[model samples]
Target: MDLLSDSALMLKVKSGDNHTLGLLYERYKKRLFGFFFQMCKDASLCEDLVQNVFIRVLKYKHTYTEESNFLSWIFKIARNVYYDHFKAAAKNKASDVDELYDLKSSDNVEKEMEQNEKMMLLKKAISKLPDDKKEIILLSKIKGLKHKEIGEVINCSEGNARTRVHRALNDLKDIYLTLEKR
Candidate 1:
């Protein structure tokens, strides 16, 4: 079984193949953990959240539809989990923080550090954007999703997704330029 293709694995998983589900979990665990880490900024909490996502997937395997992209379906669950975490954190009066990527063992740590610094600046600039623009940029640039994939995730048409991404990129560029002048 090819583990990387989510749809095929999902079909198997839905058909009483527990091993296929395990394969899917192994394939996505690291990337989804990284995504949650970036979103929630707490390694331990992100770990729990990632586990929760997989657990929920297991518990709700029967709920998955054939027409849905498996990746989008999983991400939608992750998004919901993040929102719940966000709300609970807000209620606890915790400050929202961005998690910085660890590059401690990179060959060129200095250059990596410099690049990460720039990325932090870009993240800050992106966060200042409106919600729709921020979502579009994050989905496209950070998640590396195609326009059609993004549309599937966001429940919009592909054309709308493309236009949204283009406008968001333009707005982000303007923001970056403004920040450069300051």
Candidate 2:
């Protein structure tokens, strides 16, 4: 079923339909897990967070409003889960070693090594940006989110999201130039 039709299924879920909820979980599991994996840079942690997000959704299903965008609401919950995990990790002084590895695998390790080098340079450039700009860039460019969707995720206006993405691209270009000079 299409995403719009999923709203009807969600309504069923709200009214205590276990089968509809299971279907919804099956539909979203992979995408939501991928989002968590990227954000956490840890497969195990991503799995845990994904479970927690769905658990929270099921527990609080009564609070979900028909006026809200379903995917956006789900993502917001995922985002909050990510932030909570980050806060807890920081408190515990945990290190994320998985962040150092590329998520993709290739047949040629040499070519992958070259790509990783470039990625490290790009990551350094991204690190130079202010948090807001970096977030917009990551969501828009890397995650392939629309400006409006990103605006919703970041709690900004669409125009603001567009402006920040534009500026972030310019900043990234400048950083690339600096790296080229070095």
Compute the lDDT for candidate 2: 0.71
Clashes in candidate 2: how many? Answer: 0
Regions more than 4 Å wrong, model 2:
1-4, 91-99, 102-117, 123-135, 141-145
Model 1 misplacement above 4 A: 1-4, 91-120, 130-132, 142-144
* lDDT tens digits by residue: candidate 1, 1-182: 44356887887788888778788888788878877655445789889998889878878889887786887788767767767776776443232325443324556778887776677667667656665576566667635478888887778999999999999889988887777678
Please, what is the whole-model Cα lDDT of each candidate in the order they appear?
Answer: 0.73, 0.71
Best by lDDT: 1
Query: What TM-score, computed on C-alpha atoms, does each candidate reach?
Result: 0.71, 0.71
Error of 1 at 173 (Å): 2.1
Candidate 2 lDDT, 1-182, residue by residue in tens:
54645567777778888568777788777777877654445788788888898888888788777776666667777777777777776543233334664457666789887887677677666555554465566567534367887778778899988998999899888986798679
